[model samples]
Target: MDDTEPVRAEDGCRLWTDDTGHGKPLILCHGGPGLWDMFGAVATVLSARMRVIRWDQRGCGRSERREAEDRELAVLQWSADFADPATARGYAEQLADPWFGINYECNAAITAEERQVWRETELVTACRGLAVPTLIVDGAQDIRPRWAVDSLQEALPSATRVVLPHAGHVPWLEAPDEFRTAVVNFLCPA
Candidate 1:
């Protein structure tokens, strides 16, 4: 069974959430301050054995869109060689969809806030307190540096990191079978 609902935040923002299946709960958060829950396939597979909850971040996806101060930043363009051409093209097409509208203001604000938090907080120390098992999956060819993810995995006591060699930023899109297998093995060890 799949159920979707709007959850109100303390600040009164309505976040869109979908909950499915029936065992231990696993929340799937999409990447990007601008992206929504695009984990339908992952949810479907995992939901058979566990409750899967997917939610759009504030000001993103199906959540309530809010207007904020304009903060413009130059967009970074990747070279053609950055990722596999076909995979890159597929991602571009996905982004062109109306449902994939980019929320620049939300991205900028959240990015700025994240920078501040990173600078102000002892992230490693904070992560050390989190005892829950964590799966840190990364694409070996992602444009973003992997050191940060490596550090996170090192800090968390129960964290397991999986690096998919044949993928880029969005591993599931490029290597669906491998991605599904890795996630399933981690979430439902046999």
Candidate 2:
């Protein structure tokens, strides 16, 4: 059974969410300052044995689309991150659509808060104490630096890191088979 609904946030934003299947609950979060849940296929397969829930971030996807106060900053950041001219051009074309509806304010605020947390928290130290097994799947071509992820993997005793080649920010979109294999191997190691 599939159930889609609007989950109202504490800030009064209605986030779009879809819940399906029925066993162990698994919440799949999309990664992005301006992206929606694109795990329909993944969810469908997992739903056979586990409950899968997917939600769009506030001001993204089917959720509320709030106006961004500064589009130039977002554009500049996007361009700077995708340093490769061809990649930047492709991203620029994608962002040209009104449907992108990026929430620059939300992105900025979240980034600021993340920076503050990184400054104040000893994440590496905390990871050292975590006994849980962690699988860090990273896209080789992700704009974000890989050093941070490398550091986390170094810190965690049972952490396994898999970098998918030819995949950018979203590995599943570009390397679905490899991504699936990595995750399945991690979850059902033989």
Candidate 3:
């Protein structure tokens, strides 16, 4: 599984996927809700001890959705104004140009429902019965508020949190070596 593979879903979306190494399955979810898989370097490091399954989420990266789907998303979600006019214009152009393949609707549709469910249900409480070693890595300057990360740390069992001080949402891009070191140390501590 050294090469990139395209997988077709039942709904006609073709996801670009890749797999490497051979150990416990580690599914790496890309950070940007709409961005592609940008974890190749991290994959190289972690593959030493784990089977890394990285894939571009639907309607992003190499997984292009149909024109109709893209149009629908643009119409439903691209009605808001952005902070910067140039940025807004650029993104608006990208939305109209089917090449960017951004799934605006899907990205905008995600709510705090998942987190709310985790908090409201017995899932967090039931986690008391589990004993899994978890490594939570986040950028200190991430758009996700500190309280959100703290809440996750509090909810999970045996979880260690690492915040890359100089990074934003994508720590690997901001601090590659540090990101690699932290992940390697966590997965294969010596």
Best by lDDT: 2
Provide the lowest-lDDT 10-residue window in model 3: 79-88
Total backbone collisions for each predicted model: 0, 0, 0
lDDT scores for all predictions? 0.76, 0.77, 0.72
Model 2 lDDT vs. the true structure? 0.77
Error of 1 at 6 (Å): 45
What would the TM-score be for candidate 3 when compared with the true structure? Answer: 0.43
Rank list by TM-score: 1, 2, 3
Model 1: how far residue 64 lies from native, Å:
27
lDDT of 3 by residue, 66-147 (tens): 7766665564354232323334444445547655666547765565565555554486677655589888878786655688
- Sequence-dependent TM-score of model 1: 0.54
**How would you encode candidate 2's per-residue C-alpha lDDT over 1-190 as one tens digit per residue?**
6899788888777889999999889999998877899999999899999999999987678998654513543554555434354566456445554545566599999999988887524877788899999999887777887887788789999999899877766566456699999999999999
lDDT string, candidate 1, 87-164, tens digits: 576564444443444576999999999888875248778888999999987788887878878888889999998889
RMSD to the true structure for each prediction, in A, is 21.6, 21.0, 22.1
